[model samples]
Target: MTSTSGARSHTSPWELYDGLTALVPRGVTVTTCVVSRWALVETDAGGAGLSSVPDDGRDDPHGPQDVVGQDLADVAALVRSWDRRLAAIGLASINAWCNTQERLEAHAGDVIDWDASAFERSGELVQGRRVAVVGRFRHLDQLASRCDLTVLERRPQGRDLPDAAAEFVLPEVDHAFITSMTLANKTLPRLLELSGGARTTLVGPSTPLAPEAFAGRVDEISGSLVYDAPWCRRALMQGQGMASMRGALTLFNLRVPA
Candidate 1:
């Protein structure tokens, strides 16, 4: 088990944000945007993307509710905001723009498997190798037998390392399965650097499936594309968690071409 020696970016969010902002259509007003316990947005074309926003957003005073009718390009720019609530909404917009709104960007030579989970795919490749899953995703138990596995979380639970341990742990791993929330928290750039040459997959529903945005930054993109926007929006508004997304979402993996 070994980690790669350089970083994809010491400065992140911008390089990634720049790529996504360029992809989102200009002047297209978003149809729906909400941030209660979860942040979600839908493009005018029925595309939906979701983010886990823990804050109730009731007291933020300044929020992105006005983003519904705003230019998406300007909305996408919010991903760079330092305010956590604003950043959460911004990420939701980017996910909606990149994954759902721009589904036509099937880059040539890129292969997307619609029925696979990132956990399963990552497990297949980590046999007897060192792996670090930066989020506390379920099913790590299934992977423990095949690899030297480690789990890190912002709120450490069980044996998982604290998120800060990435500086020490990521540089020594072979594969890093990073959570998409790293983008919202603006920790992704540094995490990528720590993972260096290690094969990496940006894993979560919050991930923007923009290959161009992540070219050379990651090896694979594993995320969900919401097929039923209304259903997801309703669910998010009704306080449903990710586990309750009954058939409204489809998980996919896009293997970035080398």
Candidate 2:
């Protein structure tokens, strides 16, 4: 959730990126080259045409051309030509949003409860600890509340990292729970970096549980065990996105030994 849209028409990717890039934040900038590559492939396979018009499209006085309805492969080729630029822009926008604090306080008091589908099966491991949640989505709140939690409504800033919510302020708190959606915005590594020294845990369906991939990154994993999804398989084939997909509730403990 990047909320760049206002009361007007839909916000273009450039507009959203421009609005976010104004702020600077201290977090690892995760480049979404893979997503860009996939998007290019999708466009190619789907046959969306490429446009020669500027991003805003208003600058082209001759007006925009009908790049749509072209061959899918041609569309994919055009996307490949512009993939780097698109990825750069997307990363910058993510950096901007990561630094903003505007949305951090929006749902501060929302209560989180457990959903039988995801966490109950793991038993009562989260019975009496304060938890801080990241990411924005309707169903996520349910999971957080079950853990007796508070929402970390931190919005991504253009430059500065969003403030971790009140629950994270408790130095004695037992755990910090993050979501797989963080991967969508390229903030998973940054979130790990922020929770580096704390008693935190990564809970999502997208985490890779291999000791080699997560040895120094996380402590324990708890979520869906997704080892057989088509996109995931493809990502593995392409040397990326190989994490399992256990129905979107994979949980990984982030404990490190002293």
lDDT of 1 at 148: 93
**Candidate 1 Cα errors over 4 Å, as ranges:** 1-13, 54-65, 101-105
lDDT by residue for model 2 over 125-176, one digit each (tens)?
Answer: 5556555555433454445555655555456433222445433442334555
Q: Which residue pairs collide in model 1, if any?
A: none
Error of model 2, residue 128, in angstroms? 1.7
Q: For model 1, how does the per-residue alpha-carbon lDDT over 48-104 read when each residue is reduced to its tens digit?
A: 778766332233455554787777778877877766667777888888877753463
Global local distance difference test of model 2: 0.34
Go through the candidates in order and give each one's C-alpha lDDT: 0.76, 0.34
TM-score of 1: 0.89
Model 2 lDDT-worst window of ten: 46-55
Which number leads on TM-score? 1
